[model samples]
Target: MGLLFGSFLNVVIARVPAGESIVHPRSRCPRCGHQLAWYENIPVLSWLALRARCSSCGLPISWRYPLIELLTALLFLACQRRFGWTPELVAALVLVLLLVPLSFIDLEHWILPHELTWPGIAAGVVLSWPMGWGRVQDAIIGAVVGFLVFWGMEWLGEKIFKKEALGAGDKDLLALIGAFLTWKPLLAVIFLSSLQGAVVGSLLLLVRGRAGPAPDPEPGPESTPAPPVGPEPVDTGGEEKKAEDEEEEEDDWEPGPTSIPFGPWLSLAALEVMLLGPLLREVLPVPLDMLFAGAR
Candidate 1:
């Protein structure tokens, strides 16, 4: 089930960003538009059998396919071992399904589409109904608090620093996580995510000279015929100078060296709190254990 779901998630990760229908169009090779057969789409097994290349155009398939499949299988197995056959286990499975694609999508595109986060938030609330009304209330409060916290930070950052400190979709992702985990562990989630994101982001900046994955370069402007050569025009009333200054200001607003996506860190923290918090609390020192003790 995990392998199958992982295969489907690959579709979600690929299509959601492009505003494409994950269902209507069948999986096809991007290079040759070759529609895959049922046998060709059998998760990791198919990838291995095909030698990680498109049969039609011989385009090399990304290794991420099998990695995601295996990661999902292992995570599902871990959830089973932790929660057993219960409603909580079912909830865990759904959370994993949502988080896996969300994390990868943010890592790749640095955007979390509402198509996933909004539905995920609702699903988390609805799924908690079986646990109890108190849990449902907690989930609701958690979602509200989670969104407001980030929103506040965003507002403050813009007011003080005159720049965007958080991505537009980060609050929604955190709210979705809160809807699943409830309010009690939100502090721990924030702490763990910040700590881990800082460490990894610093390393990436040192190695790659940027904290986040670089965005794809947009195509340059189309070539045009050159105008007749003439003497350079003089600035008239300083208008051209003002225009150049404004352009420079706009360029200054672009992302800097330490701009990393926060969504992946948030997702990772949520998964850690859900799956490993208890074990961590048990093994760590008393002071440190308290940080991980707030799991739902």
Candidate 2:
């Protein structure tokens, strides 16, 4: 079931950013426009069978497809073992479904679509009903508090640094997480995510010479060649100038330094708190245990 869902998630990850419908037109090869046969859509097995290439076009398929399927399967098994047969297990599974796609999408695009986060906030509150009224109340408070906390930080950062510090969607993501986990664990989530993101982002900066992707270099005047001098010049109707302008407009733009996406790190920290908070609290010192104990 997890593998199947993961397969569907691949479609969501690919299409959502482009504003394409995930269900419409069916899956087809981008290069050859060949509709995938039933056998060709069998999760990881199909990719292995086809040798990671489209049957019609022979275009090499990305390895991320099989990897996502396997990763989802493993997470599903882990949730089953941790929560057993309970409402919490169902919530955990739903979270896994949401987080996997969101994390990958953020990593690729550095943006978290509100289409996922808004519905996720609602779902988290609704899911808490099974636990109790108290849990539902906590969910509501968590959502509000989570949003306000991040909003305050963003405001302060903008005032202090005179630039945008956090992505606009990050607060929504944190609120969704808080709606599921509640306010008490939010501090821990923030702490863990910040610590991990800082460490990993620093390492990436060291290795790649940038925290995030490098910005596209602006085209210079030197790139355009001067028109040849001749007694008689053929009339090209300014096609060359138009082409150069189009190419310049199509160049990709990237964010400045220290601009890593925080969504993935937040998702990872939330998952860790859900799955391993209890164990961590048990093993850690008394002072540190209090931080992780709220989630458990």
lDDT at 235, model 2: 30
Runs with alpha carbons beyond 4 Å of true place in candidate 2 = 213-253
Give the 10-residue window scoring lowest on summed lDDT in candidate 1: 226-235
lDDT of each: 0.80, 0.79
Lowest-sum lDDT 10-residue window in model 2: 226-235
lDDT of 1 at 51: 98
| Candidate closest to the true structure, highest lDDT | 1
* Local distance difference test, candidate 1: 0.80
Tens-digit lDDT track of model 1 for 93-114: 9999998998898878767899
Tens digits of per-residue lDDT, candidate 2, 1-296, equal: 88998998899888887789989988988899999999999999999999999999899999999999998988888889889999988888888888888888887777789888999999999998998999999999999999999999889866764445577788999999999888888988998988888777667756764455443234343333322211111233343332222121112323435457788889999998888888878887998788986886
Looking at model 1, the pairs that clash are none
TM-score result, candidate 2: 0.85
Show the colliding residue pairs in model 2. Answer: none
Model 1 RMSD vs true structure: 8.6
